[model samples]
Target: MTSERFDAVIVGAGFAGIGAAIQFKRMGIDDFVILDREDDLGGTWYVNHYPGLAVDVPTTTYSYFFEPNPNWSRLFATGDEIKQYCDDVADKYDVRRHIRFGVTVEGARWDDDAKLWRVGLADGTTLSARYLVTATGFLSQPRMPEIPGITEFAGRVIHTTAWDDSYDPGGERIAVIGTGATAVQLIPELAKTAGELTVYQRTPIWVAPKLDVRISERTKRVFARMPWTQRIIRAITDNIYETMINVGVVHYRVPFFRRLNISAMDLCKINQFIQVRDKDLRRRLTPDYDIGCKRPTFSNSYFRTFTKPHVHLQSDGIDHVTADGIVNTDGTKTVIDTLVLATGFDLWEANFPAIEVIGRDGRNLGKWWRENRFQAYQGVSMPSFPNYLSLASPYAFLGLNFFNTMEYQMRLMDRLFGELRHRGATTFEVTEQANTAYLDRMTELLGDSLWTLGNCASSRSYYFNPHGEPSLLRPMSTQDAITEASTFPLSDYSFV
Candidate 1:
């Protein structure tokens, strides 16, 4: 078996891993390696390339605050543009040299005697590092539906994650099996070309109108010349999204904020009413649960796509797939030439840990999270995982924009590692007391959030884990998260 050693090892080459590597470079820590199973970086941007794919959040707020892209073609950048941005950031930071593509990390275990982590690869090789960071994103794993006879379907099957660029569905009968954010983007595109399109939705989504517009070359040139102009735009966009989360979702218990949530719901209803003419179709598309129960999306064409004569909405759940069609729970069958599954990722079952992480005392991270609730100190460190950080851990995500989460995590890394350097420490682990305290505090704070108090039982959101706890989000404002990352007590960690 081959073995290599490094100062640190990152288990993903996505934006998060790239950010960690950048922070390490800033700390003058050069002896680190990044591993990714994919042939390239960009993470989700690299994986998802379905039709009509674009950033749901405004481009001004969706990117790294440190590295601004002035060349976005629109307010909502396309998937290709985001992927290019990832490439540009990695190139600019010179982290590409430290990255090893097409390497699958099977697991990592803490070597107590060695005081290092041993990361096992799929090729029967091992790499040891003083510090380990898992940046396997929250939406890394793709989930295929559990419907019976899916394999028996004789038509072409396509998951949005594994979209075939060459295959054109024009004039082809298509049956889509989701109404999530991905489906919301894809269904509209499919409707324009598909001969007959049937959408099978288990739960309806709350979609607001997309206020998207093209960015003129003049604006780009101005942003390039005066970057502060772009920063101001970013700030405005960020505040808008933050208010949506904090007031309409997190502070749902307050009467005023609850009223704001109602107003937002009304806005979505108005959007639907304006686009969809049929009352029955509008009612079928309307979500019974509150808005924040699921991750809401913004779209102008998704609702209107149903009004097309070629498009059909099927609310009856899937029963099974026949040889050439899908059988519905309502005793109906929809024959189709193509089956498109936008079922999204499996968060609780497959992605909480993403890989086998054996920490101190052989404690399996996945099993522990299942037995106990998914808990992490500041959503980065765990009690037994010394010198390790999980960037996409429970309660790590903040607001709607992922860049906000990455920004705070970058700050947390800076503080944590800065403390390590100050103490001349080789290893550090969060104290069990701190972990429990953080978990309790998060639980208490989430008591007022929409996920906890609002009607989410039928939302079927990935936000709620198997324990029925909405532990995915931090349930706090972006500023608070950033402040805590920088000001958290260093004594909460055991350094040695």
Candidate 2:
């Protein structure tokens, strides 16, 4: 294979990847490639095209800082709307042409002698780059339920991650396993058309009403003409949302704040909660975990779907798949027409492809992670992975607007590049000692939170390790997390 090269290579053309490409253009680094497994540039929005799907975060606040769109039709835009927004950004910034779709990177090995990454593409294409940016969103890969006979099922089984246009839901008895975020959004959509929707909810979700309102045409035109007004609105809205997260999430991580946080919606009838005739269903749907323990969902019509006589929330844990459908642990077997795995994606390797990264001394990132837990300085770059940054790596997930997190990450990356140029540095990597200290600080801080040693039971998740500790997000507010990431002095890295 002939060797080719670029100044930078960005993985996964979602919000992060597209944002990075646009920033690279501003930095005068034009030779860069945006790689994704999908055939389009929307990333997560492209694949997760289920019905009734929309942004949990308010639309005005969940956008790029560089180019904020003041034309959102609703406060909470649908999945298609979000995808179109991403597409619009890609076109506006001229980043779409630079992206190569259906190209999965098999491995990325950093050559210590050459100070470049040896990237192996799935199509047997090998390329080298001076820098690497992993922009794969956290929810990229689908997590299929570990059930026996799932593969042996004679019927069609579709994961929400792999939703195709041809897979019709109308007139089909669908069994959607796992009532997490994906399941919550999909149930309302599927319930509308499916013959009978069997929602196999393992655990109930603490769902709040999605407060979506249509933006008036007059209001939109005004915001367009006076964009600074929109900016002010965005800023204020963002502050309010951040305050909520601080109260709900950051509060849960603290002792005294825990009780005061999660009970805000306990008695409120905000967005109109539906009165279910069945008392048993109401109790089964209620969640016991602190509001921030698991990811919270928002839907206008999720709970009300049970009112549809065809739709049923089966609380009984699915024991096994029989010939046609599933058998519950409670000995109830219902033969479904189809199986839809709305179970969420694996946060770690699925979102960030582990196979590609081969760092110093031919160290595979996956192997390294297996031996040692994922430790990073503010969840951006690992030690020895210089000239490389992750868009949504560990400790960088923002439950609010993911776009905010991407913007913050892109801003820091711009700063890193500026530092490199100032110091005349050809490469910038995290020092081993610096990474160790950062990791120690993060872990020690997390140990103090209610998330790690709180009343919540241990569940192996993106948030926890085998030791059952919170590692997905830093145990602090978004402002605090940014401050923590900024603590690593750029002067520590050496120039060429």
Candidate 3:
């Protein structure tokens, strides 16, 4: 079979891929294809259909900067709404025409002499591209914990990512494992209907009130008529988030931010106390580690869910599973008819394993990262992986909101592609020296960030690599990221 060829091959049809496609189209380069494993375009939104599924961030903050939506029904949009928004974006930009749905990319290898990327598909087909962009998102994969006797359990096992619509928890004893963001949102919804709900918590999380309100149609019209109004709201929202980041995330180790962290912690304490009147339950829910150690949660009813008569919280470690129930480490067995695993995704492993990338001299990207810690120059390009760009790599995940991260990545890519066209360069790759220097500076700056100094090592956070170092979030202000991506010299990469 003749292998298909294109100027670029983008893996994923999420926000990053769509954004990249739009930017490339606007720049008059359309010889590319977007391949997604799903039948539809929305990546995470398409897969996760659990009850109470919604965006953790504000709707305005979570959206694309250029294509602002004035018709968000609520401050925090639901997963279905977000999926619709992504579909609308794909429709508006005519991106659907270039997408190959239900296509699985197994691996890709860089061809040295040809100076092109040979992408492998699951069907044993090959596609050649001058450049490869991996926009496979951070939260795409779901992980289930290794519980003994899991298969022997006759009850239905459900994961948050793979929620069964036909399975009803009403009047059934349900055991939900995990206390992260997904669990926080799901527990409240389950408590309302479940006859007996038991939540097994491995670690407690710092949860703040979700002050979400429905946006009035009149307000939406005002935004649509006068787009500047929406922009102003976005600016104010961004400033508020930045201030919180300064105190809780970016500068938590600094003396000034210590006071802010204390104040924030107090607010969380008050929220929990007010919602959970039972002292025992409240104490079980309160986190021992510092705020921002793990991914923080936001919910209006998560704490209040514990006050329900049927809701139960167990902080004891789980030993194993039996045919009828789960046994706590203390030998207490709780019989339940259904089991739900909210265990989060394996961050680095899932992100890298989704696609096997073989670089120059048969260098496997996964093995390289394991041998030498996960490091990428500017969070986009690697030293050996020439013409292969990654959207959400180490030090590239801006924790404030993912839209900002996508925008910056797409912006940098636009510039790089422009330079390639102007200079007629055959290939481009970050130099080993530049990659090392960039990582060194990032390490120095992260020395004062919360991920490094603020009790995160013991939180069971997915932010850290296997070596126990936080390698996920970029530890700088949003503006700093914008400036660096905008003004950085393109000469850092060797183009030929």
Best by lDDT: 1
The Cα local distance difference test for each model comes to 0.94, 0.76, 0.87
Give per-residue CA lDDT, model 3, range 101-141, as digits (tens). 99999999999999889999998999999889898988888
TM-score of 3: 0.98
Residue-level error in angstroms, candidate 1, position 145: 0.6
Question: 328, model 3: CA deviation in Å?
Answer: 1.8
What is candidate 1's lDDT per residue for 1-496, written digit by digit as tens?
A: 5389999999999999999999999988999999999999999999999999999999999889899899999999999999999999999999999999999999999999999999999999999999999999999999999999999999999999999999898899999999999999999999988999999999999999999999999999999999999999999999999999999999889989988998999999999999998999999999999998989999999999999999999997889999999999988889999999999999989998999999999999999999998988998888899999999999999978898999999999999999999999899999999999999999999999999999899999999999899999999999999999999999999999
Can you write out model 2's per-residue Cα lDDT over 322-424, one digit (the tens) per residue?
7699888898888888898888878765644444687777666666665777776657877767677876666677656787677667667777788888878
Whole-model alpha-carbon lDDT for candidate 1? 0.94
Worst 10 residues of 3 by lDDT: 345-354
**After best superposition, candidate 2 residue 441: deviation in angstroms?**
1.7
Give the least accurate 10-residue stretch of model 1, judged by summed lDDT.
1-10
Q: How do the predictions measure up, each by TM-score? A: 0.99, 0.94, 0.98
Superior candidate under TM-score, 1 versus 3 = 1
Best TM-score goes to which candidate? Answer: 1
